[model samples]
Target: MGQEINQTQFNEQAFKEYNRRLLNEAELLQTQLTKRCFSDIGEICGYELEFWLIDHNYFPSPINQAFLTRLNNPLVVPELSCFNAELNGVPLPLRGDVLTAISKELSQNWLQCQEAAHGMDSVLMMIGILPTVRQKDLCLSNMSDLKRYRALNEQVVTQRVGRPLRIRIQGRENLDINHPDVMMEAAATSFQIHLQSAQRDAVRYFNASIIAAGPLLAAAGNSPFLFDTDLWDETRVPLFEQSVEIVDEANLENHRVSFGQGYARESLFECFAHNIATHPVLLPMLMDTSPQQFEHLRLHNGTIWRWIRPLIGFDHDGTPHLRIEQRVLPSGPTIVDMMANATLYFGLVRFLAGLDDAPESRLSFDQARNNFYAAAREGLRAQMVWWNDSVTDAKTLFMEEILPMARQGLKDLKIDKADIDHYLGVIEMRVQSGQTGAVWQRAYREKHQADNLQLVAAYLEKQRSGAPVYEWEI
Candidate 1:
């Protein structure tokens, strides 16, 4: 006799058991990570950025999946959405001024992707959400033919059953919209920033950085206006969170779908532990085989969380490495602008790590979370409550305090001055002119108010070729 089972059994008991096991696994992994620490924090680090590709006309192009399939390049990979693509750049070992090297490598990789995409009539542009993305475009047909994407989507929709994903965000005006499917997640595009780290301190530092910096970054108006509404500047922040949210409408008191429970007391282990505790695994493996020996199809159940997800993977030598995947940022007007954002974040992490006090202790986690929301609503106009309970404008804080600190931090690393200025200068001018990518986008929309979302996106595409974003005439 052979053992057999139903392929689609939703065993509540089995689900509960899996959650229990995952919590235990998270604990074990956290312990293992604590045992492995790097001596030089700055010595080893790298990053990955994902963005959607549009045509010369600035509409979502189907070329991304085709390009990846045809090119079959490791540096370039298929993303969840067909219009999406991931750019994997070489890691820069922490040393004197690795910024220049990063810039060069990014430029080369971007150009290579462009060259590959030329035949398909596609070009890459980054924004929080593609303005042209429509309700019709959000269908499953637009999703890339990848296992991870399919698995995740299946888990989310199944978990939701027939209930719609309801989003009620109060911006300049309240937004009360509901999508019958999880396809709304497609509207949330991002400029993902990767930061390499060792196991021991990775989770803690990553959590702290997110708590401290997330709000300020979002407030910079890096992304404003989604679907032609002057909603949250980084509307992706809210849109993504709600798009895949899982909830049981009948059980109102025991609502499962909610924003993060709280801030981490110590490390990323706490965040992971919280995730394990609060949400049931939308995906789980029942593998009867081994890696390099057998295939496994793990059920990647959806979660109602994750602004920044901690990932574990293997290097060429099969050495396990950990990295923080920043998922809240918007894509850019230029690569230089994107790199500037990266340098600010990279410098802040290093600077904070060297400090005596943890940012979490000084700033309430709730306040930090609040800051992010405020920034999204107000952009540079956001007022941050700093020390002495003083309310300083975001532009003042970034220009007077954070920018100088970032400069010193980068200088201490002996980063090439040329790279530092080239990037930071972009940041500086952006702040000085009040012209973030979001602001530029909003302005473009206003100029072409008669045009629909697709036409507005087309206008932005036309504008990208001539001058840098900071230099673009409004």
Candidate 2:
């Protein structure tokens, strides 16, 4: 989806051609996988941080256009809404001091972003959903000025047969609304983590990532409130799912943006095959690239927003590589909080992938998917079905089993001990104290009588203090 297209207007012939090429590329990819034709990259990691821009009143401010222009940094780019922006981190090998290195790069880039935002009379905030965001603020007029975003909006609306997108989320509170465009997606932002792997290990790592979603989301739940109403612990999950909701008439069970139908049966190639067969091509922009480039296939794959998306990219020498993108976690309450979340995910996936018997074998795909939604809805209080068919609360499971598993995983990867302890300790204190970002925000609202701006101001103050959410005062 990051790649820009030259043409948005497409005829029937264009769509047919693009679809044919996409299917062919999928077949070529399977052959390549069979022949072991991919880069032998080992455990390379990166991230994309989406954040909001706000005015002094803490309301959504549509100033990212000018802000990004003034900043003139390639690492920063526009998001769906003009008020939102994303900062990308450079890809680095997952090894000693990597966590510290990621934190340093993020902090420095964030500071530069802050300076840029200030110049435009707006401040950059890192949150899953801005508390001050209102239904009226998500209009198409506020969408970023980009051809790809415009094309996406047109295509999604077209798919719904020109009907308004309807979103209904039932949590502690109920939210029911309709929008004419996909801008509702702009209300949510996330901290998407990416891990590159060798083709031989890609399938195992991808499966492990799916299984880890439940505990990972439970330990890191941040978006609890939207539109001044308390919703799911991670409301972004449902909000995003509904924002671009599409129903295939041929197959009603599959959606464009989904948790996925099931785990990978044999190899990651099955995922690509599923995408090509099940999903209709939304974007049919003709590209003048070779079959090996797989540009059409990659673009079509980008349109289908899976939770754990498989990616094909090339190294500096143009050697193709496979990557597993983890998309469940929400963006900030703090820098340490973000890094801690990354550490837990990387460590757990590495550990789970090495098991002689795959975790997915013990845990059914339906069970894994159900556990994800439960954790998103209930946070740490959620009970999850683990391996061996045992059900336990998320907090206990993390403290007793998951944390130790992560520690060993990091140790096995030869990560520095201090880096391991510092990052994992943040997760330990957060879960043990039962004070995740969601908890802290909910507590603040109760203490302040639900003043939205005051809640945001307090959050910003605590964020500036550079303390993790667990240590912050209400």
Best model per TM-score: 2
Which pairs in model 2 have colliding backbones? none
| Tens-place lDDT digits, model 1, residues 1-474 | 001222434467766655555655565656655766222242355665677777766677866667987667778776667887777767677556677778788788877777777768876766667777766777788877765556566777787886778876767656777777767776766566667666555745575566646533643455555555567777777777677777654542223333355655555556565555456666554444333211111122124335556555445565556666665667665677777887777666666655667666666766666676677677777887654455688888778777787777677667778877777777788788887766777776677664544444553554456245667655
User: What are the Cα lDDT values of the candidates?
Assistant: 0.63, 0.90
Please report, as a residue range, the 10-residue window in candidate 2 with the lowest summed lDDT. 245-254
Encode model 2's per-residue lDDT on 1-474: one tens digit a residue: 288887667789999998889888988999998899998888999999999999999999998889999999999999999999999999999999898899999999999999999988888888999999999999989998887888888888888899988888999999998889999999999999999998889989999999999899998889999888899999999999889877743554568888888888667888888887778888898889999998988898888888888899888799889999899999898999999999999999999998899889999988999889998999899999998899999999998889999998898778889989999999999999999889999999998786889999999989888899999998
Q: How many clashes (backbone N, Cα, C below 3 Å) per candidate?
A: 13, 0
- Runs off by more than 4 Å, candidate 2: 248-252
lDDT of 1 at 32: 53
TM-score of each: 0.85, 0.98
Instruction: Pick out the ten consecutive residues of candidate 1 with the lowest summed lDDT.
Output: 292-301
Model 1 spans > 4 angstroms off:
1-24, 34-43, 55-57, 198-204, 215-220, 248-261, 287-305, 314-321, 448-450, 453-463
